[model samples]
Target chain A: MVVSVAHLGPPGTYAEAAALAYVNWLNQRGQQGLLCPCPSIAQTLRAAAQGQADVAVVPVENSVEGSVTTTLDTLWQLDKLQIQQAHVLPISHALLSRAETLEEIKTVYSHPQALAQCQGWLERFLPSVQLVPMNATTEALKYLGEDKTAAAIASSRAAQLYHLPILVCPINDYPDNYTRFWVLSLQPSGGGSHTSLAFSVPANVPGALVKPLEVFASRGINLSRIESRPTKRSLGDYLFFTDLEADAREASVQSALKELTAYTETLKIFGSYSIVSIGKL
Target chain B: MVVSVAHLGPPGTYAEAAALAYVNWLNQRGQQGLLCPCPSIAQTLRAAAQGQADVAVVPVENSVEGSVTTTLDTLWQLDKLQIQQAHVLPISHALLSRAETLEEIKTVYSHPQALAQCQGWLERFLPSVQLVPMNATTEALKYLGEDKTAAAIASSRAAQLYHLPILVCPINDYPDNYTRFWVLSLQPSGGGSHTSLAFSVPANVPGALVKPLEVFASRGINLSRIESRPTKRSLGDYLFFTDLEADAREASVQSALKELTAYTETLKIFGSYSIVSIGKL
Candidate 1:
């Protein structure tokens, strides 16, 4: 059976790279995988939730920029998608353009996150150049084809894929930039080391989050990450997303979540997922 | 003394509007306040921190998009700035262009947040239009002069300021969108009900956050918000930002903070601040 995987693209995007890596991982396990590209992360995830694809690969967090709120927010809204796997991709950005020198570049185009990651370099080199944010890194490649003064910050792979010359490489401000992607499927996967969940506490209560944290704490389960996103109802209301260093199927984790319901207004477990590092893939 | 307030701008940006509202608020209090427009939020906050401006006004949280990570991350990095006041401004986006109809718009430009907020409208009306993200919403104003096919999603005030035609009004998908701006000063302000703070705990500890949170819970201090940002060190490490529904000067808040220090590796109290509503200002 062919497994359809959806990701943000028009090709040469980091999400596409992640989807490719995941497909390789699946193929190694004796499963056929197909790729489907969507314009936005929301549409990519929706493809999985709506059953247009068997799985969706979306970025969850970046080392330098933190959580991808759109991913978390969209995941919260889509009820059926369960995380099947997490993949870590090391990010390296290159300036792709027809311009011979940085001084000749009039504008730089990239994904907002990539632009931000390369902010220090841009400020130092092309202080006055206009920075345009696009839907994806690859989206800027089409514009760079005819404009000699236009540059795009994207993966070196993108420069090769788009046949653009790399004027400069490793433009990201931080040397250790990485983004984590999640492979989400409609059905929950097998045993894994990490469990992701989100919950909202009853409003207007003191330490509404404490009881929920204590649920994991009392059981000696360590939380790998926690993020709070506004509920969109108002400023103060929030939905907390957390990652626990334990499997959802574990007796202790199940017991903790069962007890956690008493303290939360709403709760969702995004399934237990194991991490896969795409080293030099 | 003329109180110089720094904000992201190029006349008619929302930050400029917020700065104007703040200047008016100060004028009513019998103090002279001046506006200094910076090109970016980081520069605006830095101006306050470096004493280039007396205070800086920056968007902290938006009802639809949640916390602005740039504001929070920059605040966390700059320790000298303290919360002075928070102002909530209702956001209404208008499509500004020379084009007479939506079909004439071949491209759309706006700040990333504005573009995201008006995503639904743009998708419905100009599905094929290229959406270009600028640093500030008003930055797109200058580009609309010759490009009849380019429409910008910005404030109606921006259209008026730029002498551009309002092609459409209320372009944002959500009518109730509001952005909360923080007035940051070099010194702590007085008599505020809300206190903001950020802290990082020692890595690899189980329940590292629970004890610090218990301090507030035990003191009956309700938290208004909590957001976690990556430490930029690695994937799992994070720095947590929280808002407490109590004055930092209060005894309970002081005691809780004192105990919080024991559980945290580092903690910063970003002063206490009151809220002001900019009701159609």
Candidate 2:
């Protein structure tokens, strides 16, 4: 029997590295895992939903960047898929190129997030070079194959995969840059100390959000995050995505959620998930 | 005296339109206003800070998409800039091109935000067309002159400025899409009813944010928005940006802020300003 994990990829992206890391973790637990690379975060979610992959790994939030909207929006839109586990990967970007010298580079390309992470570095070191953002950082590897003048900001794993030379390691502006990826599966894996959920409240009511949060605070459920995304209906109307320290199986948590559901116009549990702190593979 | 307004531009962007609208508003008040086109949001803000422009108008939020991080980050970095006024404009994207028909478009270009806003439309109408994201939607205006196969998702104003035909109107996924732009100036504008502020609380303390809100609630001050971004120090650390219904000069708001500043490690008052809403020109 084989287990398949889907992730955003052209084979060398951080998402792909995360998928490899998950596979490594699964292997330690006596499971044989196969990696399935998808083009977009939306497709990565769909791969798991459609059973092309048993699970999907997609970035949820970044320590530096905040929420990954593509992942968050897709998770919200796809009602059936549930988060099985959460993984934190320290994002250490590198300047990858075929060129021997930085002065020879005319264009630098990577994922927009990657480009943004290295904005300060690119500005300081390669001020005159063009910055092009692609779908995935791995896609930048392809551009450098023919153009010696082109460089890319990507993971060391991307450099290794594409057989490119690393001009500079850890090109990210902040050393503390880290990304949290959520492992998603069609069914709930269960047995997790943490639970993630989203809910929307009536817009017109003042202190509408405070009430639902009070339900958690009253239960002493420590919330790790509370991110508000626009409902797309109007300005100021939002859907709050929250992370709690307890799973639905806990009686106190269940009661709090019941009270929360009553207060919210819409509520969703993204399933219980444990955090996996792993280094990039 | 000519008062200059700076905005993000290639000349046909929403930001440029907002600048023109602001100039119109200023002209109505009998002030001679000059339009200044900037290459980026950072440049636009810098223009005001360096006295290159009297004020700068840049998009801060979208109704459907939410906060503009570039605007938020730049504002946070430039502590001297103050909000003169907030402007909300209806965002209606159109498919603009030299091509007579949608079928003739082999590639679609837009700003990443614009692309995301029209994702559903592009997927439905031109599924296989290559989607390219540029710095501004207006940059796509130049591409049409060279490539008959290229189309851009931008405003009707952009289409007119570029002398291109609108292939599709209101291509955005949501009709409720509106962008809120902030008019920024070096000097604080006095006597506005609305205020915007940001603060960061100690990470170790649970319910730290709750105390700051309680200050507002206790004073009966209405908060319109609360957005949290990563502090970039570590995971779970955040800086909260908030919007209030009352100006800092108001007795109630001042008292609440005084209490809020004491509770948080860092607090910044972005100044009090009223909102000026105008339809997209």
Candidate 3:
């Protein structure tokens, strides 16, 4: 059977690139995969949860921007989705435009996160230009061909795909910029090096949140990341998402999980997945 | 001296309303205050840091959106600023337009966060409308007067200020939506009920993060909020921002803070301040 993969796209988004890499990984493992691009991240994940696609690739975190809240919040809401694998994609943005020089650009457009990632560079170079936020990076590329003063911040692959000139390459403020994407499926993939989960502690307790973390800390299981998002009920009410450096299938992890339930009001194990680091676009 | 206060604005943005509320709070205490609106949150904080403004009121977090990252990141970068107070403004977004009905709107404009806060309502009502994100909500108001198909999401105060008709009010997805703003000054305020601080841990060490949290936990000091932001050096490298339920001036908080330094590579106390919740905009 051909495996169907869904991702945020107009064919050239970072999510699409990550999905392509995931499909390539699947192909090497004897699974044929097809790409399905959706207009937004939420829709892409929902496609997987509803079985429109076999798997969904959604960004969870960015080095420059921190947590992808929509991805985390949607993942928390969708109980059926489970992690099958993970990918670390190095992000390199280029200024795609019809204009020959940066000084000629009057407006720059890209996904809001892309604009934020390149904020320092924009401040120094295109300080006065209006920055427009599009739903996707590739969504802005179509305007570049017609407007002389229009530019877009997107991957170098996007420049090739859209036939736009690269006025400046690697325009991200940091050299170490990277985004982590999760390959989520309806069923759990049991074996992997890392485990990801989210939980909410009983509200207004003095040491409520720390008790859950202590469960892993006592077992020498390192926490790779921990972030809090407002529960949406009110300010100060939060649900936490965390990643741990241990496999959920391990006996020690199981013990920790059992103990964690005692401290948490709501707990979810998003399944365990191995990491795959992509070298290029 | 006429106290100058800087905030993100063009008079009718949420930040301006926050600043105005803060100024009113100052007047109640018998101190004169002035409003200095800046184009961005970063500049608003910088105005206080550079002595251009006596104080700066900037949004730190929102109920639905979580942390105002630009505010946190900017505060972390500027060493001179200290939190003098905090204000929680209940957010209520209104659709302001020349159009008579929602069906007549083809393009909707607002700050990106405002758009996100009302995502559920927009998806159900204006599913196919072009969503344009402006730097400030008020920035979108100017176009609403000329384009019959244009609508901007802003506070009802903005509709009154701009003389535009409100097509809908309280369009945010959640009725409990609110934003928390910080009043920052050069000198540290010696008294308040809560304290905010940020710290980075030594990278790749097992259980390094838990050690710092244990300091507060062992002291019975409650953490109201805990969030991690990328250090911007790499994907996994992080700096934590947390708010404690105890004041920095308190003995218990001071002791916990001293112990916290041993586990952290760098730490910054953003001062302690009491929270003031506003009844209406």
Candidate 2: Cα lDDT at B152: 88
lDDT of model 3, residue B200: 95
lDDT by candidate, in order shown: 0.90, 0.85, 0.91
Chain A only: list TM-scores of all candidates: 0.97, 0.96, 0.98
lDDT (10s digit) by residue, model 2, range B1-281? 88899999878899988888888888899989888898778889988989988999999889888889878877887888999998888889999887887888899888889999998888899988988778789887777885779998989988887788998898899998889999989886775878999888866344666778778866777778888888878888888898888888988887788777778998988999998889652
Per-residue alpha-carbon lDDT of candidate 3 for residues A48-81, written as tens digits (9 for 90 to 100): 9999999999999999999899999999888889
- The true-versus-predicted C-alpha distance at residue A271 of model 3, in Å, is 0.4
lDDT over C-alpha atoms for residue B195 of model 2: 91
What DockQ do the predictions score, one after another? 0.72, 0.63, 0.78
Interface root mean square deviation for model 1, in Å? 1.2
lDDT of 3 by residue, B181-272 (tens): 99999987766888999999976666788788889989999999998999998889899999999889889998999898899999999989
lDDT score, residue A86, model 3?
Answer: 91
Q: Which candidate is the best by DockQ?
A: 3
- Total clashing residue pairs per candidate? 0, 0, 0
Which 10-residue window of candidate 2 chain B scores lowest in summed lDDT?
Answer: B202-211
lDDT score for residue B188 of model 2: 68
What is the C-alpha lDDT profile of model 1 across B1-281, one tens digit per residue?
Answer: 89999999888999999999999998998999988999889999999999999999999989888889899889988888989889999999999999988888898888989988888888798999988888889888878987899999999898888899998899888777899999998886765989999999976677899988999999999988888988887778789998899998899998899988899998998989899998853
Query: How well does each candidate superpose onto the true structure, as a TM-score?
Result: 0.96, 0.96, 0.97
**What lDDT does model 2 reach?**
0.85
